[model samples]
Target: MSGYPDNPSGHMSGSARTRRADAQRNRERILQAARELVHEPGELKLHTVAKACGIGQGTLYRHFPTREDLLAEVYRREVEDLVAAAPRLLETHPPLDALAAWFDRVAAYARVKRDIFAAVEAATWQDLAAHSLGPIGAAVELLLAAGRSAGGVRADAEARDVIILISWLSRLDDTELDARGPRLLSILVNGLRAHHRD
Candidate 1:
C-alpha cells in the first residue's frame, strides 16, 4: 500500500520532472558561465555569459533578475559547496591537514568567488533569507573545532576571525594576492602556532 492518498507520481506529470531537470541544467550552466567570468577579471558581459551558458538572453533574464542576483546565487552555491566538503575532507585527511587543504580550496574560491562576494557582503539578512542560505557559522565552528582539538592550531583562534580573512581575500586581484598571499599566509600559520609545554 502507498503511504499517501496517491502514488508518488500521481499528482505530477512527466513534464514536471522534465522541467525540474531543465531548471537544474540551467543552474549548472549559469554557474559555469559565472566561473568563467570570475576567472577573466573585468571582461564579463551579459551576452558573453549567456553565450557561454548556451542559454538565450531571455532565459538568463528569466532566471536571474539582474547581475547582482546572479552573483548572489554563485556565492550562495560556493558556500554550499564549501560547507559540504568538510566531512569528506575529514575522512581523507588528519584534522590539521584537512584544515590546511580546505584553506587551499578557499584560496581558489577567493580568486574566483570575488565578483559574487561583494554583492553578498552588501546583503542584509532579509535580502539574503529569500534564497534559503545555509548555516556557514556552524560549518566553521565544526571545522575550526577539529583543527583546535587536533593539537596543531591556536586555541585562541575562532572561525569568526577566519571569516574576516576570507571575506577580505576575495576582493584582491591576482597581482595583489601574488604579492601579498605568501607573507600573509605565513603570518597566519605562525599565528596558529601552538604553545609548547616544558
Candidate 2:
C-alpha cells in the first residue's frame, strides 16, 4: 500500500467523471478483446476488435488514439501475463517441472503472436524486444533461484543467460512445438541444479 494512490483509482472532475467511467469500460473491453490475440500480433482488426469488445470502432480509436498505440498496449499486457504466470506455475508444480512448463507456455505463445498481433516491424519488435525483457528476466531469475534452493536447479545458470536462451526459443514455429522446449529446458534446468552446477 506504500505507493497506492490516494484515490486508489484516479481523480476525476465532475465534468469528466461520466466520461472517465465510459473510458474505463471501453478500455476493459478492448483489453479483453486484445488478450487472446496478444501473441499472434497479426489479424488484430481494430474495427472488428471494437465490435468484439462491445464498443464502437470510433470509441476504440478514441480510447487508443491509433493502431500502433493499441498494439503497444496489448504487447505490454501480454508481457505482463507471461511474467504473472511464473509465480502461479511455481506454486503448482515442482521446481524443475514448473520451469519447464513455463518454457513450454512461452514457446507456444510465439505461434499465437504471428496470427493476432500482425506483422512485426523492426522498430516495434525492437521496442518489444527491449521492454519485454525486464519482467520475464526477473520471473525467470526467481524461478531459477527457487529451483536452485530446492536442490533441483543448477547453480551456474544465470537469469540473463536464461532470458537469452528463451528469446531464441520463442522464435520457433508450431511444428517445433513442445519438442525443443522440454529438451532445452531440461538441459537448462540441469545447468541450474546445484549438483550439476554447470
Models 1 onward score TM values of 0.76, 0.72
Local error of candidate 1 at 147, Å? 2.2
Per-residue alpha-carbon lDDT of model 2 for 1-198, expressed as tens digits? 354434646665565677778788889779777655454434556786787777788888887876667777766766788888899999999988888888777765555544333454568867776877888899998888888888787777788988777666656665565567668767766666666435
- Cα lDDT for residue 129, candidate 1: 39
- What is the alpha-carbon lDDT of model 1 when measured against the actual structure? 0.70
- Name the lDDT value of residue 150 in candidate 1: 85
Candidate with the greatest TM-score versus the true structure? 1
RMSD of each: 5.0, 5.9
What is the C-alpha lDDT profile of model 1 across 98-125, one tens digit per residue? 7666666666667756655543445632
For model 2, where is the 10-residue window of minimal lDDT? Answer: 111-120
